[model samples]
Target: MSVSLPSALIGPLLVFVLLDGFIQGSVVSLLPVIRDTLHTGTGPAMWITATQFLSAAVSVPVFGRLGDLHGHRRILRVALGTVTVGCLLCALAPTLGVFLAGRVLLGPLSATLPLSVGLVRDRLDTAASRRGVSLLVAALILGATAGTATAGPLASVAGGGRTVLWCLAVLAAVGLVLALTPRISETVRLASGRMDWTGAVLLGLGLTLLLGSAAQGAAHGWHSPPVLAGLLLAPVALGLWVRSSLRSSEPLVDVRAMAGRAIAPAFACGFAAGVVVLGGQGVTVAFLDAVPEEAGYGFGLPQWQIGLWIAVPALISFLTAGASAAVGRRLGYRAMLTAGFLLMAAGFGVEIVGYAVMATWYAGHLLAGVGIGLAVSGLPTVITEGSPRDRAASATAVYYNLKTAGGSIAGAAAAALFSGLLTRSTHQPSLAAYLLLWGACGVLALVSAALIRLTPRT
Candidate 1:
């Protein structure tokens, strides 16, 4: 477990992870161009991203469990190959259906991080594992920032969105090649039976229905038939899955492990982070772009300028996350986590109070970025460390899935808030809505800090 790996051994994983983040970020910026090129309506075009999230919701845990059963390296390589093919299909697809198939293939991209974490934890010593996980998190954040910042420019230079997709495909292929190389070591595999297919299917089905419902409800109304049906059936599937898992000797995911002190609290942190940070991103951009005169309060910035504002905080986050492990080492992870949440609360408080001031807003974002970096990077380590050695990836997967669920829930709530509190003339969310959201986020952050503080040390 303490063995040192050659950079070559781990390099491929970093590339795969960074590329995954890049693709996720870049696609959002290029949605407009992609839509026009494919001649798709707004609703269908949006599925390009939604499909991936749905896919990830299912794939993350499945892949994690598979990696635990087989080897992390084996599963990671398979995932890379799948995503590579997905990229190629997307690049060349002539129709929306084909593109979505490709996107479905691309879902495994999100699993790369957890897989890599498991691999490093299995191969590296404790200190090294902590550092490695932190680095991967930083790489992800960095890649996303770079991708989002450059996607528009890259498309302009390349002449078409397809060209950008092609470039992404090529990068994915390179990562796959690296994964195929013999130099990379395989992780320690489980000593037990085959993966529990029934549990996987039930869990996947349940999560898909639940996430799909949230997504559809956010887009269309919550009362839509599909959403209603999904809401009604998701619980049944999930309940059955839970019952089966408890009964099985070797469930796909050991549900019992989830109740442990370290994992449960870490998961709570991830969920809170998703709700307070990840979920509000769209509204943040909207806030930046809203016309001040019409909306009564907004910066009235152009899209490019809004990206810059976002980039500043992201850059800070990248730096902070990269250093978070070392800080945790010095300060103790519990204390670090507590501080992280406090910083986020302070950030949200600043943003809420100084809504009209640009400098104050930027400072608030920076504070929140630092907090997010610490929490995001540290939470995974906590989960992995506390997990059964063989189940590290599975534990991380649960944390991720829960985080995504939180984001979906928050997104739905935000949409409802904006719609219900629309400014009469502009038909935009009232400034009061943003204030209320931030206030809620701030309160939640404070609550999370207390919870982390109260959580029993592993």
Candidate 2:
């Protein structure tokens, strides 16, 4: 039960996790620039980021299945190669549609994080693997921060954001090269069968439908035909897939295992965790920019400062992740999750009731970050520990997919909450909308904490 990981194990995990985070964060940071360069409207422009979200949700489970069927290293190579080619396409694309096609190729990176988690579990001793997982989580968050903080400046230096794609391509290339280097060893028994292609298709289509609707629901009226079709069919398709999986001798995911008390709460929290982390981030930042100086709610910070300020919490979150493993071990994973969510609730609560001074804002964010770091670090460990060693990738992928879905739903909720709020001439949300966002985050965090409590003590 030694909780120390060797550099050999930690290095590859960080590389893949960081790549995933960097790609996601950088692509998002580039949307406005892409829109300006392509001369596209917000609706068309959204595909830049939305495509990643949709693809990630669907592809994660498939990658997980692939890992269970094949070796994780094999799948990891494919995923890294996919990202490399995708970034290259993005860099070379002459048109918006072509760029989007390139984005579709990069979707496999979504699966890389969970796959890395499984890789670590396969290679390390139990306690060391747990610590490795924490490092992976930290790299995921920290790399996102690096992407957000650096991409803009890098774009400026390179004369456009397209060069950032080139850099990403390079990173992906390095990763592909590393995948050839034999370091991370596979230890788990591989699940045998033809890959569950039918289940994969169903799951992919269902997620695409649900997330596509959510992404577009803000712009298209909720009652729009496209949105309505997705809303209705998503569940039907998913339900059929579930029924099929239960009957199939070999399923992509073990739906039955998901019902066990030990695993159930982790899945539940997975969804909430995504909503709070991604959605809470959106809400917190939007509030910072939206609160007018005259309104005494904000200090009228510049965009760079605003991003930096927002990172205060994220930075704290990143640092907390490294220590989260040991902390969770001492505190118990359940207690850690409970406290984390409670802290997040407190963070949002401050936003809801307190003044918008700089100190108050940072304090709230820092507290929330601590909570997020603790909960996120704990959830997957629970999943890995509870799942059969052979199905670790599938289990981790399932949790990760729910997290992506939660993020999509939360984004839509934020849009719905702030819809139609035009601040005078500016296109920002009104103060009231920001307040609502904060309150919503607080409530969701509280709910997440309650879910952790529902976990059995076994």
All candidates: TM-score? 0.97, 0.96
Give the alpha carbon lDDT tens digit for every residue of 65-167 in model 2. 8887898988998989988999999888888898898889888998887788877777777778778888888889888888988888888888988788889
lDDT (CA) for every model shown? 0.86, 0.83
TM-score of 1: 0.97
- lDDT by residue (tens digit), candidate 1, 152-269: 8889888879899998899889989888888778886562667888998999999999988887886888888989999999999999999999999888888887766667778888
Model 1 score (lDDT): 0.86
Clashing pairs for model 2 are none
Strongest candidate by TM-score: 1
